[model samples]
Target: MGSFQIEGGHRLSGSIQPQGAKNEALQILCAVLLTSEKITINNIPDILDVNKLIRLLTNLGVKVEKTGKGSYTFKSDDLDLDYLHSEQFKIDGSGLRGSIMIVGPLLARFGKGYIPRPGGDKIGRRRLDTHFEGFIKLGAKFRYNKEDRFYGVEAPKDGLKGSYMLLEEASVTGTANIIMAAVLAKGTTTIYNAACEPYLQQLCQMLNSMGAKIGGVGSNLLTIEGVEELKGCEHRILPDMVEIGSWIGLAAMTRSEVTIKNVNWNMLGVIPNTFRKLGITIEQQGDDIHIPAHTNGYEVQSFIDGSIMNISDAPWPGFTPDLLSIMLVVATQARGSVLIHQKMFESRLFFVDKLIDMGAKIILCDPHRATVIGHDFKSTLKATTMSSPDIRAGISLLIAALSAKGTSVIHNIEQIDRGYENIDERLKAIGAKIERIA
Candidate 1:
């Protein structure tokens, strides 16, 4: 068990480079099982969840070699399809939701795949219905056995054939799974209402680099031209968008002047404008976002039409639901009030009680909405021991501690370690007084 002891009231200063996208890394790592040759993945995040997924891959006899820092070569020339029947495989796959992704490629190559229920941030109801349905559309049979909550999939007609799939939601993992399976299908595959997140974009680009034909790279509609086989190729991951959002919130809350380099600006379309509503000053220098220190804190702004401002998360080109927790904390320091709506995840807004404990005014309307009133920050936040609920909330709590007045202790940091790499070390490098303790 590791914890962080952070002293508040310090401005974090420095130029920091964002790591490879954790979301993308997980998706791409699972995509490796689709091919049998050496597939080089560059800019992979060296984080716990990623390492855990890598361990699972190696356990199945996949050849994995570290090529460089945040880079690796994965060869799936040898994989035990029956590895899923092992108790150890069940344990590892059930520990993370990304494991569900292995089903698509496995079924595509072997015509049969079995996996236990996947796990991830218990933020809300994350469904695998879309994933199963997508596979079904591509000619796969599913057996949902409640006794073990396991999913067993088998293709009836040789294997999955590319077909038009209209998804209910633009699920990132679901889209990735379909794309991987579709690449080896027999005809043109059109995915409607597909998740066009930057991570998915990177996945498509990588698939295209490997000789898979994909059109509409950054849109909700994707056209994948099925090929007999996808050859291996080198692909570099993109910078972490959620990490950039976290750092942006940290700079706003701690009044720090920090520069986030190579942020992939256009990818952050509404994120900047969304934060700007809280009166946070952000400078766009080419691909970097510069946040200046403002001890007084940013001011929360309402809509130009003067309606009570609401920040909600949608599929894409919308405020991401993942960052809603951090935005809630930022709104606490702003001068005005706003309603943070999390439509995608039901339990995501549940973390506001911690902020309320820290002297922020917040009303939890329900599991989906919360009203946050700026505290004016006249009183100092007295640190208390806290536990992390999920990856995003864990980091949000850390940011709250960073803006608090005294020493704060946060436990169960392994949850945080799953996504962010060496967070305490990274904060320390930026002049933050944070120490890790056992």
Candidate 2:
């Protein structure tokens, strides 16, 4: 276990580039298994989860070559199908949630996919029923080994045939997995209620580049015409929207003037405006976002009817649940009160207890909601020791530590490293006083 020792109340001023999309990189990296030819991917984030997936691919006998910084070429010509059934493979494959995505491409190419129960952040109940249900809907036989705790999907002698599936919910990974599996199936496959986040859009675009027919690229309804095979292609990941939102919160809470560069403004949707409702000034410069230091401090904006402001997460076009924690922390320093509802993940708001211990006024209404009464810069936070629960919450706590008075130490920093790339180094580049201690 490692910890970050941070001296708070420091003003940061500079421009920082957002890391490449973590969620998109996970999907695109797994898609490398779709073809035997070389698939070159650029702008891959150097985070723990991504590196784990790459190592998993290497273990499966895929030829992985490092082209340059944040770039790699993967050729799946010699994939070791036997390795998939090994105990070591199951152990390694269960390390991250993204590892589950490998099942789709593997099932599509080889007609069999095996994975142990995957492990990731303990935010809430993330079910795999959507993925397995989609696979079963596409004419594959699903089997679960209760004793071994493994999931396996196998196709018939003639291989999987396309079939229409309407997802119960717009699950992002489930949609991507089904799309990958359906691309090599026999006929056309239509999916409704598919997740339309930018991550899925980039996956669809990359699949099209690799010779897959997918329509409705940026909407809930997706139609895939199955092709015989997929060829290799080059793909680049966009900036991480969640990280961009965190930086905006960091700038606001620390009274820093920070500009997030090359943010792919078109894809950010309502993220900037959501923060703006907290009375934080967000200026868009072309593709960049400039968050100026609130010299006069910040306030919360109420609705036209003047009710206590509510910031909640929804499907895409809605405020992302991942950013709600940061929004909650930012609200703690604002001029008024706001209600943050994390509808998707129940335990995400549980970290508010740590913030409350730091002297912020927060009422945890329940497992899903938290109402924050802003200190309005009238009171400075008193730093203390804390532990990060998950990736988003870890970064949120880090932002709080950065803005609080005195020194704060955060343990279990590996959670933050799973998502953000070189975060401590990046923050230090912009004048943050944080040190990583082993």
Candidate 3:
């Protein structure tokens, strides 16, 4: 496993342009199998997960070419038989929870698909019941092998027809899979409580251009009217909103003056105001966001009872559940006590023990909540080897290392690279000492 050796304590300063959204890229990449015509995607983030998906697509006999640095063109003139069942293919798909997203597109295109249990983060129980349940709504039969823990979905002979179903929750990838499958189904499909994050919206927009009529661009209720066929179209993905949030947290924790460029300002409705409560100063410059270094750390805002406040994670437009870990690290320097709650997953709060070792006064209340007491000693984290748990947790560990004292080595950097694009290269431009070692 590759590792990252990072020396900490120096403030991060520079202008960074976040690459395209990884969540968006993954869902969109699976959409390529929806059509055989040539489809081009620009501004794609060069990340591990996307590269893995590209290789998986190639294994399926899809033509994937790099036209430029961040541009990729995919065309499936002919798909290989028995590709998904190959050992290499199953192993690759099993590594990423996102790969399960391809099940819907594949089932739609080839009428049958096989997927082992997908793996991404160890953040508690991520259920595929939504994915399989969605498949059932599309008139497909599914069977789970208890031994292998794999799922296989196949449409009826006349091809699947759309229907009305309510998702248990707004599982992001689940919504994407159902949307892709319904796009090619024969009739109308209505999905309620669907996750309408920016990434899913982008997928819907891309499919719409390909002649899939999907109603509800950014809402919980989605009605996708299935069409006969879809033609390929070129699309440029929007900048990542999550990275923009991470930059906000990093600037507050490191007290660095940084301007993040090409941000989609309109999409960032509740994020800026939410971060401001913590005393992080954020200014919108057209489509960009500027974060100034604060000598005095952010303020911890409280509830109606005037108690110590915390920033928690939620679905889109609510404080993102993904950034709460990083925010907890930022709160350590602030003069207040707050609780970090992750409503989506149970295991996300497991890394706070490492922070506790670094001199931060934090109480692990349970799997969902952590009471972080700030205004502790201004100390440094001793160099340690840490393994990443998930994409967000991996980046959070990096943030803790960057803010810690001395040097830290992060093993299994592939987890961090799974989402962030050239993170070492980008952080180096600012002033952090981070090197990728084999």
In terms of TM-score, the best-performing candidate is 2
lDDT of 3 by residue, 45-143 (tens): 999888988888898899999999889999976998487777887788898778898889888888998888888877898888888899899999999
Instruction: Give a tens-digit lDDT track for model 1, residues 222-303.
Output: 9998887878999988888899999999998888899999998877768888898888998999889999987786778878
Q: Give per-residue CA lDDT, model 2, range 1-438, as digits (tens).
A: 999999999999999999999999999999999999999999999999999999999999989999898999999999989999898898888888999999999999999999999999989898999999999999999999999889999988898898888999888999999999999999989999999999999999999999999999999989999999999999999999999999999999999999999999999999999999999999989999999889788999999998999999998878888899999999999999999999998789889889999999999999998899999998988899999999999999999999999999999999999999999999999999999998
* Deviation of model 3 at 175, angstroms: 0.5
| Best lDDT among the predictions, by candidate number | 2
lDDT of each: 0.87, 0.94, 0.85
- What is candidate 2's TM-score against the reference? 0.99
Candidate order, lDDT descending: 2, 1, 3
Q: What is the lDDT of candidate 2?
A: 0.94
